[model samples]
Target: MRELLYEILTSAGRRMNFEQTARLGNALGGLLWQALPGRRKLAVEAMVRHLGISKPEAGRLAKESFRHNARSFVEIMVTQRMDPRFLAEGVTFADPERVRFLAETKRPVIFATGHLGAWELQTGSLGAFEGKRKIVVVRRPKDQALHEVMMRLRTRPMVDVVPHRQAVMPVLRILRKGGMAAFLVDHNCTRDEAVFLPFLGQTAAVNLGPALLAVRARALVVPGFLVRAEDGRYVQHFDEPLDTASLEGERDEKVQATAEFYTRAVETYVRRYPEQWFWMHKRWKTRPPEEDGQPRA
Candidate 1:
């Protein structure tokens, strides 16, 4: 049934141009906003607490975020029918010099990003500039049908997706080979796999994978995001790499510091474009043991 519904949606999406599909997505998002009042409220409350905005302003941002996210999803579906070359050409880098340097370097690189604008496209377009295959780390959907659907949409000639559960050795091997890997570091993680850090204006549990991989592999951790413009094109931005050399501590402490650095980088972009983030996620759901009134083990 889920596969059938996805086929129906993609079939309809493929018939429309990008603009038409985006309009349809906006309508769908509006309906979703109305239907999921609890999620909408969660997003609004998050914005108010983290962004320090009033309820009305947060509500506006939440609605816009839903629309933006829906548009991105429909766009992904539309991309299945579009030419990959054309899609790659539509993305431009914000800092060409930095990108060129990255492309020329032989060092392993780890791209740390969030569920921000055209994120799927961001990973897809990397092959155009980097001239190498990219290993993308992702949490696969538990439903087999949905997993197949996502794999079909995400698979590209120059991109490979590795499930998080089995990503450690694969990512490490790739990085050791001086290859590039991308991780979406914005999602809430399990307590056992997380390090508490300051994100936005609140303390949240952040995934330790990206930083741990970077530290262990001695790869450069580059904070990057792909933002959408009014013209529907994308601008990929790559910030300076985190200074891993300056981190001096035990292995765990180094991992903690690395996580903090990359988390701050993600926060900067999220604050600048609040509506582009995936706010429906319970980013702060996992609390520290002390906060939960439990002694640390």
Candidate 2:
């Protein structure tokens, strides 16, 4: 049933113009926002706690976030078959010079981002802009059927997906070969193998895999995101790479510092575009082990 629905949506999305597709996404996102009462509650609470905003403001932001998220999904679907010229309309590069620096070097880079804006299209855009198929993205799907569908719709000529469970080794090899790997660093995990970091004024669990992989592979960590602008266009941002070389300490400390750097980068972007992030995610699901039997501040 999921596959059937996905096929139908993809076929319909292919024929839609930009405005029509965006409208469909807005409708769907608004509907979902209203239907998922539990998720809506969580999103609202997160906004209030993180932004320190009133409930009304949080509610408004949640609604806007839903609309943007749905539009991002449609943008992905439409871009699959749309001409690259049309898709690139109004798109800007935030810091192409930094990207050029990475591209000119033969060293591997770990591109880290959060689930903000049109993240699904980052790899493809990078490949197209740089004229290199050097990116392998890590994806964590909810189910096998959805995963297969995403692989079909999301993978571009130069971009590819690596499932989360089997991603470590493949990512290592890519890095060793002077290739890039993309990671959405804002996921919640069940494993205790994570670093505690301050996110949005709260302590959140962040995976150490990206840091560990970078350390082992001797790769530079470049953090950035593709965010929506005020005029409804997209922009590809590339920040300066994290200086892992200067981070001298125990292996555990280095790993924790690396994770914190990524988290801080994400927080910077989220603060700018508060209403364009994945507010519905349980980003703080896991608590610190030290907080056991104690109330959170």
Per-model CA lDDT versus the true structure: 0.82, 0.79
What tens digits encode model 1's per-residue C-alpha lDDT throughout 168-231?
Answer: 9989888887788999998999888898898987788999988889899878888999888878
Candidate 2 to truth, TM: 0.92
State how far residue 87 of model 1 sits from its true place (Å): 5.8
Clashes of each: 0, 0
User: How would you encode candidate 2's per-residue C-alpha lDDT over 170-211 as one tens digit per residue?
Assistant: 788777877888888988765566888899998888988888
Give the TM-score of each candidate. Answer: 0.91, 0.92
Candidate 1, residue 51: Cα displacement in angstroms equals 0.9
Q: Looking at candidate 1, what is the lDDT of residue 106?
A: 83
Name the Cα RMSD for model 2.
Answer: 2.1
